[model samples]
Target: MPSKYRNFRSSVPWIILFLEVVLIILFYFLFSDDDDASGSTNSYPAFQDVNHMVIFGFGFFLTFLKRYGFSSTGFNLLIIVLGVQCSVLIEDLLVLLLQREYKDGLQRITKAAVSMTAVVISTGAVLGKANPVQLILMAVVEIIAFHMSRSINTTFLQVSDNISMMHVHLFGAYFGLAVSSHFSEPSPRTEKNASTPKSDLLSMLGTLFLWVFWPSFNSVLLVEEKTKAIYNTYFALAVSAVTAFVLSLLTAKDGKFRMTDIHSAVLAGGVTVGYAAHIIEYPWIAMILGLLASGTAVLGSYCLQRCLHPALKIHDTSGIHFTFGLPGVLGALAQVVLLVLKDWTKSPRLDYLVMIPIGAFCLTISVALITGFLTGVIVNLKLFKTIPVSKYFEDQFYWEFPHLAVGF
Candidate 1:
């Protein structure tokens, strides 16, 4: 291929990457100035609401990316990181917009309708092969996990617990569904009967809508407090994405891993940084941590997919290998590394050290096991068994499309 045309063809994706980096940097600078003016003597919660909303929204979006058309394995990986960033940031911005009061009944109705509409649309869009009832249960479990964090005394520990718990909940829900889809009583439908997974065109068409808006998700509120951390994340993501892109081509399963997975490092790095985004002072440490995180996430996901799943003969693609599982682990590791570094460099506090990981792990495990087991049992009993668990809600439309066959 001629360099000119090739560049022309690739220019769009490159430009999109450039714009995403620029936006993240721009946001960082804006926040950094505020932080500098405020000085290090003062510290706030680091704009958490914005971060939580963004992560939640993005995580939710990734679950349905295949249906939206970016089903290529590689692209889907990248979508995981990018989608989380985009959804969280956009949701954060929306919440900001919603904070304003409106006196007119018409405006109130419009806002209410818009908010409710978004919840409905987002839910419907992602449900795919999932039953609406199961989806509701999943959401309920997630909410319970969220409230559990409130009981913790330390803010840092609370945040960490929330991150870990939410992931476990997600893993439990998806894994439970995958298991039920396979082993549970004769459902008229199963994974084998699923509608062909759609290539998520929305991902390719938009060229990482979330990546471009990365800053909105990361530091919209605490840009000032964590300016350096914010910049580090963006800088790392840019480098990681380029690296992933080149490697993705070399490792392509035709289109299985999609070019997006090339940037898998970005998500791992982002999640790793997410833990210390507010207070990590050492630039060198942050850089090294981010780089190591990327490698770990990629390798970890691969090992889990190959060694663990096949051994069990469990083809739950949405479980430990994907969705929130690996990302959550990466997040936990990041916390550990940051904490270790702090303890080594500063005074060691054994009590706090022991509490962080133990507390997080225990909470996550309790929630996941309880939720997953119960959900599995419920689904196995043939109650609410009509729910869709495949990619297209194929079961629901089966009557209209008689040719569609389900399996165990």
Candidate 2:
């Protein structure tokens, strides 16, 4: 990379931070009205749990790389901070333009946090490969695409995804994979890509946080049947965790559990169950979804991921394709089935029950792939600093290693 470009890249964060401050100031003055002030306080508790999942759960989860612990957690935090601001501005602008109203307080902040969740999942797909500036750029563009796709689903398609499974998990996974596909290079394995016992333990802590609070994530935005959503999520996650452990042992060559499988596959139930959380009235049904989700995730981790690199040239760093992508699609399909079965005789517009979810599913993929590819193109342009292949997963590229100093 040229020195000019390196200098420019270093200034990008400062520029963005300044712009965020300005935008936030403008937002407060321009959109701060009585309606915004009167936003409900009921959602605060759920907001706290979901916020924790975003900041801590996702931040630590990506620290599995042996040499990239600092960048993993640091970039996660940076992306979320940028993502939340951009999400809030875009969502509020969309609401004002379409509905002729303003939104604020815990409601919009919670929604922004949820939107950033998708960005974080996408970040997982390209974790060690991209620079901080590129990641920030990706978050801004992805947030815009997210709101657009969401509007299309809710307003035009009339889709009812109470937990945003399709819009968040499915979209995020595919988008990140698409970006990864664009950034893919054929390089031999390196120590930087490997994990240590300590790193894996830290990553497991993140997974545990996500698993415990996933019920809150699924039920946060619901006005009714919150208990049902929470119960279904908990039931599904419990089953998924047990299934993940058993399957990990079965799938391994030495018949032992893999930390990676436990890290992601155990949370498959949370992602898969959200699509139909409100509709599934039976615990057995939630358990079935859990079993299917864990199986799909474990198989994808064990089987499909290997094939993906060779076949499609997609190097999913965190295996988001299996954990979020495939399981999310399964959740969407499950919702389709429940929608048809449960609403077959009751609803007048039965066509919507089938068409909306399917359409939203297809639309989410199209938007994610297109936007992600475009973002990848922009990130790879000569204007930004390029990461050398040798430094791909090494924290020394971006972080200080004081312990390595002879004087120290």
Candidate 3:
């Protein structure tokens, strides 16, 4: 017990040190965004990619839980997700203040309220059992997806035309899940685990919330076009509903659908639609394409699970690059195709062809190089390491204690 106590004592300081480092990095990005040494309003807001906080944080949390051998409890996952979201909001506020931008307190509160509520709901669903391998894979995938998106933004299209951002979140979820399965331990409540009535109810509500707000989340900081956004939202909703219902039925046990797949599908379907939402206007065409996109991506994800992952030994759920980044780029290019086929007045063949090579180059090479390099640096430096591999399952390590970090 004395050794344990001494170990504990040393850990607290290390945890504090890690938190300080994370906070400092976050602030650096915030400060950089606000940087205008020449005092020009023209400085593009520093760190427009505040979404990285969640992607990285979520990846880190998974890594933390996995390295410590914790369970992937619903509640635990929820807490980590909430913490990441909170960090984003805090970062956002810092950015807003730094830029001297004014916004309504009510709007800010509303966002904060909903975000917090989501965290609470997710936390309530906890059941611990983490996989470190999976978590590491997740971090790797997210970094790749982010870099790919960044590359697309830089190389393809005018600032107003950038749509790659929507793909990162979508793909991240898929890739992360894949990686988790490969490296993480199985949840105790596997398919055989019965869903409590309460769990089912909560899952239903959570699905609805994500479905409704998905469009807002996707287009939040994009150039505003309310009419286009609304059309895209409904189109996405219809496709997601149809796909979720079908997948649920196909995977049901005793006539009751597997709620996990249902919830994940809704989110995935919404994200799949995000890629082409801005460019596609016709509802029917959007629905047809959305369904195709959802089905194909899901099928690809399933195949990745059984064949590619097992054979290659590459556990990755950083679906951001795969699901959204690549698919969305294709979706955008598809828009150009639709126009060519549907209209007789003019041809955009040259522009459309140009996008194909450009999108491919950006997603495959640029994202891989940039994101891979950064993630490798972080992992090699052990910037996001944690301890015990098993202790993390207990709330004490992840939430209650600060000292259980790696090397402590």
Candidate 4:
């Protein structure tokens, strides 16, 4: 890299920080006087859990790469902070412009966290291939697209998805995959992309955090059916974890568990039950969804990922498609099934219930792909610093570390 390019790359974080400070000032002036903007105290605990998942769970989960632990956790924090602020501002501005009202503070923050969760999930797909500058750029654009797609899903399509099945998981997965496609190189997988035993252990800690707190994520926005949502999410997660272990044993060559499969497939139930978390009245139904999600996730991780890399030339660094994409689609299907079964006779808008989820599913994919590809183009432009293929998945490219830090 040229001296000028290095200088520019070094200044990117400062530039983003300055802009975020300015936005914070603008937000204070815009919403300071509105008494109703502050939300209820009751939501604090759930918000805390979701925040933990977004920060710690996601940050640690991406640290499975041997040489990229610092970048994984550090960039995860950076992208999340940027995504949250941008998402909240965009959502508030949109609501104020269209609805003549602002969302309450806790609600806005909670939703923003959820929105950023999608962005973080997307980050997993392009993890080692993109620079921090590129990731920040991608996140800002993604936040805007995320809110727009969500509005189209909820307001226009009237999708009954309460847990952001299509809006968050599916959209994030495909968007990231599309961006990964754009970032793909002809080079084959390298040793740096593989995880160390310590790193895998750290990543599994993340999995446990996500596994424990996911019910709160699924039920955070619900009121009437909060308990039901929690219950369903728990049942589904339990089944998925067991099923993931079983599949890992069956699929591995020596009957040993692959930590990669455990890291992702164990969480399949949470993504799978998201669509109907609040509405799945039976534990059996949730468990069935869990089983299916685990199978699909394991299959995609073990088999489909290899084929996808060559056929589509998309390098999914953390198997986001298996963890979030396929399971998300299954969740959407589960939503459709539940809606049809429950509303077929009682509700006159059965068609809306059935078709809206499907429409939202399709719409999310379209929006995510178009926006993601466009963002990829912008980030890949000569204006920004790009991660060279040789430097991919290595933290020393971006991080300043003392000798002692590497001793462990």
Candidate 5:
């Protein structure tokens, strides 16, 4: 970094910031046109919702660790901004190849927002272990992979509705898990990975923020069904939150509550019903999804966090496999089933409608898994090796902590 840009004490990674500025300038001046001038300022509210999800939701959601708060939130801030900045260029290029049109810079920004949401989820899976540079690399590669899979699903596969189910959640979850699986093993779950009361409070705040705004998150692109989307997503989120609270104790040994439930299960509603949040006309369906999704996610978290990882020797820090992966799968499957059911009510043939989402699901999982694994392998190569094992989850190595962080 140049002397002028340096913060003296804090390591700002100014080069990345400079690149971000250049990318934002290019997105507006380059991809958009003065002649067409098509866009709706009406979409600004939804744009804000997406921005919060990326900037605040993902950042705090990963801040559940005690010592990793700085890395979790700071690195998140850095990578997501970069992800969104780069996504505009990448998504616009994909759209042009398909001869599609976008309204304006604001709408393009919302699209970029969802792209960042996907990248942040992947970052959560590999949280606390990756350096800022590695995370930047991960964000760039994951954004490209997310776009390719999402573009294919929307275009060639014609999988309509539940865009987040297949594109954002499933791809991000699996990709991050695949990457984390190859990263160095977890250091013992010491204070290094543990959360303090303050951190838990921060995590809850993130959870509530995501829970409250999720209705808007899923409803952003709804043309005529915005109200239905809002109602279903809202109801589903409520049901899931209550269910996660109850089941967190019921499922735990000695009937004690677990932090994992608070961290992951409560938000299953947003994930499980996301695809059909607008499509489903009934609140009952939404409630059923929330109940089932959160319940299943917690149980999966229990198994993966306790049994499966111990048995298999795979390292997952935040239990991404359950929180994101299981819910994503359930949501995608439910969406496909609903799509077919909706088609059956209107049309005679079920085969064609059923196969499309199923195929997209299969294709997306394969692409995410393969691409994610390869990305992980590349990062693990000598060229991009991660930090030392002893220093895996702590942030003092990367960031200058407060109150004389270095001398302490």
Candidate 6:
């Protein structure tokens, strides 16, 4: 707790050491003399792409806010790093609990990346309000709950759906929103959401990173279907990105586009298509799904930020409900129609829907809400203590910043 020992750089060694120890234990337990543990070597490229998406893609997406840029990126890194480490341990433990063997190497890393993505998404709801420590603790709880619910869904219930929409998108969005209830009381509805031209350009970098690598995320470990998966994701994103901007200009009060629309809603296609990305054979259908997803998300942002914020009495810094949450639910719903109409029950391939997935979805919803609420409660307790309001949304409280140039 000494000031000298508690600085950011000083924390690096312990974090690295902890991660190394966990990885060693996992590798030890999972190491195999036979090559059976390792799946196709092709997953490596996808794994690296997913890592980038989790670290840079999600981090910069939240940096659209003006003053809190550093905290957005920095805290995102912290929570994700911790979440990735915890993911390996927790996911493997669940596998062992189910009497299944743990997978080694890239498979484990892929799982970690997906789990970390979920944690990152959840952080969006409470961005700039909580310190990195609270986010880390929240990830610890959420990841476990996510894994448990995931296990019950996959192993026992055997629902059919892709990993991202069900496991990452839905779980993260709801969990973060639930925690946002306790993140803070609404703060006079500030114009802090406004972005400068430069910030808009910077935000596009996040958007593009996600746009390019999302195929890898949706297609990971799908060796046979990876190409088709990538194809659908690409088209879906293309349509979403274009539709979001068009809708933004059409719907904006000024008849101009909202930068926030470009920043977040453009990504709705990825969330929408996630449910059926690999399964949908037609590119046109993917585009339509993207359009549907972006339409609701882009249009709702105008209304939700205006009406829902005051009504719900909670401020969601990221407007994540519109970007990730609603689109994710839409993806799930659209996939159900595809399943029944396409007669997926007849196919040998089963993805996320059946009775079990419905249960898993409901379970994740319940667990995430309860866990997030308790996390808020625990962080608020004097033992952990929430960050003071004056200190919120500023980097000065934690980071050591040099004197800035005028107007910077």
- Writing each residue's lDDT as its tens digit, candidate 5 over 227-292 gives 998999888888998899899888778888877686798888888888888789789999999999
lDDT of 1 by residue, 257-334 (tens): 553454344444554555555556766655665566556556655675579656654444233333234554565566
Candidate 4 residue spans exceeding 4 A from truth:
1-5, 32-39, 160-166, 404-408
Candidates in order, TM-scores: namely 0.56, 0.94, 0.58, 0.94, 0.91, 0.88
Which lDDT tens digits does candidate 4 get at residues 212-272?
9999999887888999999999999999999999999999999898888889899999998
True-structure RMSD for candidate 6: 3.8
Off by over 4 Å in 1: 1-128, 149-198, 204-207, 220-224, 253-257, 263-266, 317-320, 387-408
Q: Of 1 and 2, which scores higher on lDDT?
A: 2
Deviation of model 4 at 65, angstroms: 0.3
Cand. 3 Cα-lDDT: 0.44
* Total backbone collisions for each predicted model: 18, 0, 29, 0, 1, 6
Error of 2 at 86 (Å): 1.1
Worst 10 residues of 2 by lDDT: 30-39
The CA-based lDDT of model 1 is what? 0.42
lDDT of model 5 at position 187: 56
Worst-scoring 10-residue span by lDDT in model 4: 31-40
lDDT of 5 at 351: 83
Where in model 5 is the C-alpha error above 4 Å? 1-18, 21-29, 33-39, 161-166, 405-408
Q: Write the per-residue lDDT of candidate 6 for residues 316-391, one digit (tens) a residue.
A: 8788888888898888777767766677657564543354445665776777778878877886665444666655
Off by over 4 Å in 6: 1-40, 160-165, 189-194, 344-357, 404-408
Candidate 6: deviation at residue 132, Å? 1.6
Worst 10 residues of 6 by lDDT: 31-40
Can you give the lDDT of residue 232 in candidate 3? 74
Better candidate number, 2 or 3, judged by TM-score: 2
Local distance difference test, per candidate?
A: 0.42, 0.85, 0.44, 0.84, 0.79, 0.75
